[model samples]
Target: MIANRAEPSMTETSSVWGTADVSSGKGASDENFPVGSLLISKALRPHVHAYYAYARVIDDIADCETLTPEEKLARLNAMEDVLLGKREAITRQDSMSAAVLRASLTRTGVPFETATDLIIAFRDDARGVEYKTWDDLLRYCKYSANPVGRFLIQLHRESLNAFPASDALCTSLQILNHLQDCQGDLIRLKRCYLPSDMLALAGASQEDILAGRTSPRLRRVFNTLLDGVDDLNRQASTLPSHIKDRRFRMECAAIVELAKRLTLRLRREDPLAGRVALKRTDAMHAALAALRGWS
Candidate 1:
């Protein structure tokens, strides 16, 4: 369970919460990593897809630039309502995503928090909340990233003993994503996931984030975050071994390896120059990782 999670502050469910589909058109293929990959059993794949679709819907609402904060919060509340059976979905996509996931969770007996907790983080994103310290960033991840891992764990009936390593892995991946998209986030959303104190400690300024390339001080900030990612990867490397399921273990191993690989790329390359990402060939390394973890 996510202990001591702060409730998001939003207006009471508006009487007339408007419905509009604001999907970014990002399918499973548009993600940074695989979703419902071959590692998961065919039978269990739909539940995973259902959960991903719900997440993507709420996520798109938070990131949609056109919606005001009130509109975003209202849409998010509507999603929660549909997800928890408080109301029926007004939009077709909402019915397909949130209402479906609600039914799926009822059948599977997974905790609703795995899906609802995401709204908290997305609410923060909608409000343009910024972080001050690494701990603050991790707290954001508690809502944003950690629940995804927890959902998988619960879906597979894994022990909570795996939570520590899983949280580390998820948080690292989230931070790496922040680093990779830092420039574009600033340009589009005016949001910076990079800890402001870390930037000040390294003598880097927000101005450096928008520049054509990473400045020296900004590079130092990136390296510091990467160093933290190194520690996280070390922690997350144990996640596969902690799992009881064979294929899921392989999936965790591959994801951990991808997180590690992306960390290395961020260290070696400049994200400000362009999007630093894994190539199709990187799948070979991920496959080998899965094989090594197979028992």
Candidate 2:
């Protein structure tokens, strides 16, 4: 496991959700998503980029500990206020989150309420909260992750009937994220997404997690969790068909390709040390496959 090191400050707190001001030469190449520059219809690209930026910002605020609990809540609320147009403008001093929220709301045409729910989820993170059961985690997913998918779906003007499947896909993705970041969350961030009840059922505990080794008991527990992920993936496979529009179908396919790559990583039998992020080459291959099917 990696040492529990503090997250480095890469941007001003308010801009963590937007592009960082990297010098042209070196680290600028490492940006995730680069959705800003991807070759797509100009009208659609900005909305997609705005949603990604919003999600990125909330994730950074939740993962990074630069703010106190009170401060996190205030920043989140302020961002929601900005989304509602209650604030004149979000200053850099306010929180990068507010700026992202403003951009996200403006670009995607997402309702302020949806962004507010996401902010509430980040507020929950400030307290280091954990769920006690699958239902609890699903409720968390409702606020933490599902809104992003729902917002994107709305941007495409897809039917609401697809929301159930989208919810499943979004929650599955969230679980995959939890699995990938298990080691980092325990050792580096001192947090755990595994429910206490499930840990007890698996013969593991918070202490066992912090110990940084996967015992046979932990393996058994991890396998059970993986079973759940597999089921979710199966359900998610049917989601793309729910979106009849070719572009939205392709987007869902791209997402499925991402889930497929993560599922591949989980096939390994070892104690993880940090996140098992997907390689870009694999994603590109998946995108090509998706495009082929659409064509």
Candidate 3:
């Protein structure tokens, strides 16, 4: 474990916590879906960015090839301490985003768990937790993905009823991402999010995830996950109707449409062939979905 020490001054770069500067430089546009898009009101956008920045910081730490799992956890704990105001982010290595999120949470009354729960997921990723069952994968999404939707709903002052749909939507989005990146994740991070049981049931194994194309057996596993995504999107179809904020409602509507399109494409196309992504014309489809939901 890293020894605890006082936060460093701006001029000082070294600290008890090792700082390797692991920023991935990925941003909202690089994301599979929208984050703080134009549909989010101007007043709330900065708060969204704060949350994203903090999430990125933790994600970068977890994904950094150079850091050991213990080192990653230590950095995560240090960031969380600053986020909770247990310590100041005065350290040259500490992320300003943690402080920004702490202040934003205080100002907006959004629960800090919306940010901290992500830490839980990052910890799991850093530790390389195994997936045995569908329930296990869902449990992962409970922390890794659901919080983002919950944060947005809370920030918009939406009804508690929206949570179930938001969870459905967010979890679906997360699984979609896992499917899209299954091959790359296994190759790069030596990680696999596909449930072990599902792979087994389909006569596939974790090793098969390394294939350049989706074999028939592996495609069976992909189909099973997509079946779940289909149902989750159905549940989330009601999400747009729950939002009172016009722009946000449109945003949710657009995302829901995009999720549906991506699901269809996954069903029709092979993710292992390459990165399966939304085409530019999908924007027109989302715009139409947003209009329909707006009314």
Candidate 4:
């Protein structure tokens, strides 16, 4: 998720997403999946980039610091209106990117509601909401992460039969991101996504999170969460087999591999000390796994 920030100047050309570059540099780097990977057909690349741009812009608004909560809500509402056909575009500055996203949805026949669900999640972020249980966190993933996978699946014309596996894969990736960025989310945004009940079971509190240290209790809590993530990774391992499209199956395999690798790293590394991320070599391994269609 990106915070309030301007797009990077280097991507200002229309090369990246078939629209003006609306990416905040920070957001681009934070994305875990290969947005323009070769595994995706060339025809689908534009739609993928458009979807990513829309998500990036919305996340930036929710995460932006200079804007008040009220302002963020207003901006999100305006974007939602555009997505829902209530308006044409956000502003002259955003019109091209907005048009590209709208066109992609129209061409792919993906429902506007998919994008709106993401808006709902961003609204929660703007309001500084917290999760009380693992179920509550999953509900958040429903809006925040699952829709991206759903939209891509729809774009590929895959059967709805694949959705369950897609959801598991997407949710696992979301959890991996949450675990990796827990420290930053707490320190920078005053947000915590870890379930309160689990923290309590581990004898940890929100204060322990604020202290920015990995105590034994906190480690136990994270280990418990890691177990759940591992389960999801296993569930998602079947996704590639379920996908009918060969290219999409490869892409799914790659994402699952990346998620599995990241989950392993999160299991060992302390989030508070520094960020945990995949190296370029790790990404290459994922790509090769995709090429081989390895689940």
Candidate 5:
């Protein structure tokens, strides 16, 4: 049994279905990641919504501009405590996402320990601990991306170890996201997840990045990173084979297409200032292609 603290009662029972609701995945079309859209079957949307809502909540708390680092960490810790069937949280203010997490805990028995790892990863953002190497980024992914993959595996009653292919696909997507958001991560959050070796390999310095300059060295660095992303993209293509469900296959396809497109962008576009992204039309095409492939 998880420890119980004097936390607030789980009183809010509101179904998260609002326009701005992250769980409902209404704005998935605009997201960098395509998981929400790919998982849009009516029967499964609710579960996906629940997970996305909870993720969005933890993410918001960790990323929100209004909260201080200590406050964010406290909230995240409280969230962790609540997740493990523990009764203690810092506050029970009935946040949209917290409520969703609570309900997920009650309904799915998703381990609080795994969920807590995600919260801790988000909290790491507040501490401004940037990745110095690919292994360092992998540690971050262990907490952030790997847990989500593990939870998804549990959702399907699969073993985390049994589904190495799926895990690879999931982790690949997560790393791709980090690469895509490098500029935003640095400018907006003052965080850099880029590996130091990659930087050195490119002969690009943090000073060059901060100044928004696109030297030949920076271009080479992106090429190297892009090459790594290509390997992950290939791994993602085979993810459909790991799971039996066709729905997940469709999801994998959509994500694979998106990854492919990103890889294309890296090859063709100059995304150095960190503002690189895929357009909606292109994403829709990719998603469509992926869905068709599964069909």
Candidate 6:
């Protein structure tokens, strides 16, 4: 059925994900893939953007402070219904995100299960769940992060052999983001992605995280976590070479380089005192890394 659906026009994709008015969350930015990057084949950009838009809306709903948990769950469920074709899309203004995702699935042959998996993860976030172990957090990344890589691989028609590497890369990126946002996630959402077990090992606790201050114990925890992140980046660095498409290979290389750089920063800096973000120079370095295939 997906194979039979009509491909979406570039115009449609731009209207949904490229419009200036979309919320300014990380999902809305070119964090995953730079817009108009020559590394992506032109035909696939719209579909990629559609996926990004779908993800952005879900993230915004889960993170919205003013919305009750019940409200978030209800909205997420409605999105599931729309994706399943169990309901027509809601009113136009409210439904654009879901509509775009549906179109993307149809046009790109990306499985609906991918989007549904993301919803499951967002639902977990809405429930204010905290991971108890490294394994637990990795499991969460299975739904929250790996699906995006799987979708991109499917879009590119890459071999299944590439999946393991992709999964490692995606999961690592998710953990990197969690480490970077540990303070804000605790302060605003009361959600801690850092494993409780690790915190214990570091002689830290949720109370310390809530205070948004890095104690000596917390610093030790961060350092240990950064080591793990470095290992993940090393594991993921091999993924670019596995990609069959040269351009996509470069893209994959760039992502690995960027993640490596970010992890390095996370290792040295205190997340509570300030934010860690990629600079223009970092972007340039990533681009060069991509070109050189030097993940």
The C-alpha RMSD in Å for every predicted model, in order, reads 6.9, 8.1, 4.6, 5.5, 4.4, 3.4
Rank by lDDT (best first): 3, 1, 4, 6, 2, 5
Q: Give the Cα RMSD of candidate 2.
A: 8.1
Which digits, one per residue and each the tens of the lDDT, describe model 1 over residues 19-95?
33685544555567788788998877777877876787788888888889899898888888877777755535654
After superposition on all CA atoms, how large is the RMSD of candidate 4?
5.5
Highest-lDDT candidate: 3
lDDT of 4 at 157: 89
Number of the top TM-score candidate: 3
For model 1, give the 10-residue run with minimal summed lDDT: 8-17
TM-score each candidate.
0.91, 0.79, 0.91, 0.88, 0.80, 0.89
Compared with the true structure, what per-residue lDDT tens digits does model 3 show for residues 165-274? Answer: 99999999999999988897888788899999999999999778887788999999999999999999999999998998889999999999999999998999888888
- Each candidate's clash count: 0, 3, 0, 3, 0, 0
What TM-score does candidate 2 get on C-alpha atoms? Answer: 0.79
RMSD to the native, candidate 6? 3.4
Comparing 3 and 4 by TM-score, which wins? 3
Model 3 stretches astray by more than 4 angstroms: 1-20, 92-94
Q: All models: lDDT? A: 0.83, 0.64, 0.84, 0.78, 0.63, 0.78
Ranking by TM-score: 3, 1, 6, 4, 5, 2
Predict model 3's lDDT versus the native: 0.84
Q: Give me the runs in candidate 1 sitting further than 4 Å from their true place.
A: 1-20
Residue pairs clashing, model 1? none
Candidate 6 wrongly placed segments (more than 4 Å): 1-10, 17-36, 92-94, 210-213
Candidate 1: global Cα-lDDT?
0.83
TM-score of 1: 0.91
Task: Encode model 2's per-residue lDDT on 1-295: one tens digit a residue.
Answer: 1123322122333345345321112122433223333433466665565555555555565666556667666655665665565664433433444554455566566676656778777777767788788777777888887887787677677787778778777888887767766776776656788777788987778776655556777777677777787787777777677777776677677776677667667666454644456677867866885795474
